[model samples]
Target: MDRWVGKTAVVTGASSGIGSGIAVGFANAGINVIGLARRTEPIEVLKSQVTGSGSITAHHCDVSSAEDVAATFKWINETFGCVHILVNNAGIFVTGGITDAGDDMISENDIIAILDTNLKGTILCARHAIASMRSNNFDGHVININSIAGHYVPMSSKFNVYTSSKYGVTGFTAGLLNELADHKNKIKVTSVSPGLVNTSLNVVAATTTDMPALRPKDIADACLYVLSTPPTVNINELTITPVTERRL
Candidate 1:
């Protein structure tokens, strides 16, 4: 945390839920935070509310759009010069299963949306952020806010291609790590996968379950720990589940 003071961090999906929590946590730790989200109003509200040595600047970005992402990073570079940390946390889900037919089936557009936002978006942001880190000759860190579904598919049918998108994230994180290692890059990557969290992402499960569920801030705390580690140490993956979670 001390090492990161006055440094810059980029947090995607910062309008709400886990992304918002992580943005707040990092800013409070004295790191200048650039909050990116499609909906800028919430982030703008948060900017005014943040109280600490650091601050949050809201930027409108749709991670699924390469143009938007590129423009946002360009603005960040012009404003902050370098990105010390990046959190790829933007994601979305819609109701449908792969095997369903007719009206019950997930539409092609929805499938594309899931893949674009969850998988492609992560890659795009990381690509740009890594470029910034390399060009500036700064040792940077990337933390992907993955899900338990990234590790193993749950028994529920509601997830549909959501699980597939997350699985892609799991693979992408590993592949990126190998690529970085081959180049002997000082850039570190981590995947923080959590079981059912009590965010808009898991609202139904959170309400229906009598068992324990993780909160948005819980994931934030986990990420903070990962960021606070020694530069030489890279946590490959961290899977956190509430005590009562039944999944593996």
Candidate 2:
């Protein structure tokens, strides 16, 4: 569907994985995609792969930092005029047992860092996007990339901080949705939780068995589907998981 034709989208963590997939997907659908990440290399690669003539502007910014996020959003607004959609997909995973793991394991510092990046970073981006949307008198959406871990405790190794942060994201999304509901179909907020995606975030060297995993494109497809829906419809939450994994 060309639902995104002539629209502008901002995708965080667009350098790789799910973010890259989403950016490219939007571009293919005729949307102008603004790819934001700490690194510019992967975004450049993504820009080259876009099928249509739609544009892809790569911006370097660390989503975890408020300063960077604000600056990047400002740049996006000035450059693109209006941000029709925002995909908050920037995040990190540092897994380890709460008690057994060493300093590198989810330490106090790691917990703070994870929370800062996943939760606070998401908030920062959403805040800026909301302000811009309100000021421009434009209706837009904020899509957070959550995980199955946010809803259920995994049988796998410890992921204390990651889990907490994701749960925070879910909660934030719910709250934002409620607040935007008053807009009477203008603004929307939603979260997509996927299980075991094959990405660099899953530190394979530290994990045990390798199980079936979803591809980044799968999450991208979900995002596109959500965006394609009419403003009258709101997809509050969506979970994507591999069928082989018995756990819900």
Candidate 3:
């Protein structure tokens, strides 16, 4: 932890939920955090509220958009040389079911939106963030915010393509490991799969989900733990679920 006092970290989907929590945690750790999301207002509010040694700067970027993602990374490279960490946490979920329809139905665009943000966004962020690591010879880390949904499908979760997208993320993490190894890069890639988090992402149905759920800060703690490990250690995958969380 002391070794990364003034480094830069880019956290996507920092507007709310787990994303914002991780951004706050990093800022408190004296790491300059660049928060990217479609809506930057919440991030701005969070930045103002935090009293920490590090700072949080919000940027408007739809991770699904190639132009937005590319531009955001370009700005990061100029503003903060060679990112030391990147949290690919931006994601979306269309409420209802896979075949849901009639206002509650998941449309084609909705499917694209979910997959684009959850899957493609992760890939793009990883691709760009590692570029800096290679350029600066910085042994950085890329943390992908995955879900238990990716590994196992729970009953009546009403999640359709969301699970598939996360499954893709699980695969992406594995593939990324090989990509780095092939390139002979030391940058670490970790997939943190959390289960049933009590987060209000504004995407999931606004129900009072009373089931046992993990907090966003819990996920943040897991990420810090991953970072705190000696450089010789590389956590391939970390799955976190509440004690009472049911495993389907």
Candidate 4:
């Protein structure tokens, strides 16, 4: 934590949910945090509420768009210097059976939307983040906000494509790790996968304690734990689930 104070961190999907939690958590610890999302209102609110050694700034970025991502990263470099931490927490779930005949649930647009944000968005962010680290000669951390679906598919409807995207994340994380190791880059990439997080992303709204779920702050804490580790330690993958979560 001392190593990151006064440094920069970027968190996507910061308007709400996990993204917001991560941004606030980092900012609370005296790290200058930039929360990027399509909507800046929520992040602006968060910026106002953050009371800690560090500060929070709100930036608008639609991670799915390459142009938006590029511009956002450019702004980060120019305004904040280098990004010490990038939390790819922006994601969305499209509810519709794969067999959606009416094209309401699983349409072509839905598929593209999910992949663009869940997969391509992460790749784009990582690309720029790596570039930032390389140019600055800084050893940084890339913490991906993945889901349990990345590891396994559960018995559920309307989650097939979402699960597929998560699996892509799993594969991508490993690939990125290999790339970093091959280059001998001190940069660390970690995947924090949580099961049934209690966020608005879930259509069912699992607010009851009886349901197995994790809070956004819990995931944020995991990110902090990873970042807090020694630079020599790289937590390649961390899977978290509520005690009530049953194994399939």
RMSD of each: 1.5, 2.1, 2.1, 1.8
Candidate 3 is scored at a TM of: 0.94
Candidate 1 lDDT over residue span 21-82, tens digit each? 98888888888899999998898777665677888988999999999999999999998999
Best by lDDT: 1
Q: Could you estimate the TM-score for every candidate?
A: 0.96, 0.92, 0.94, 0.95
Residue-wise lDDT of candidate 3 within 40-136, one digit each (tens)? 8999988865667888999999999888889989999998887899999999876766763544667898889999999999999899999988888
What ranges in model 1 sit over 4 Å off? 101-103, 203-207
Candidate 4 lDDT, tens digit per residue, 118-168? 999999999999899889999999999998889888766657588888998
CA lDDT, every prediction? 0.90, 0.83, 0.87, 0.88
Top candidate (TM-score): 1
The deviation in Å at residue 102 for candidate 2 is 7.0
Alpha carbon deviation, residue 93, candidate 1 (Å): 1.0
Q: Write the per-residue lDDT of candidate 2 for residues 170-234, one digit (tens) a residue.
A: 99998888777776647878899998787888664225465678888899889888887896888
Model 2 stretches with alpha carbons more than 4 Å out: 1-3, 100-104, 183-185, 204-210
Two-way lDDT contest, 2 vs 4, winner: 4
Instruction: Show model 4 residue runs off by greater than 4 Å.
Output: 101-104, 204-209
TM-score of 1: 0.96
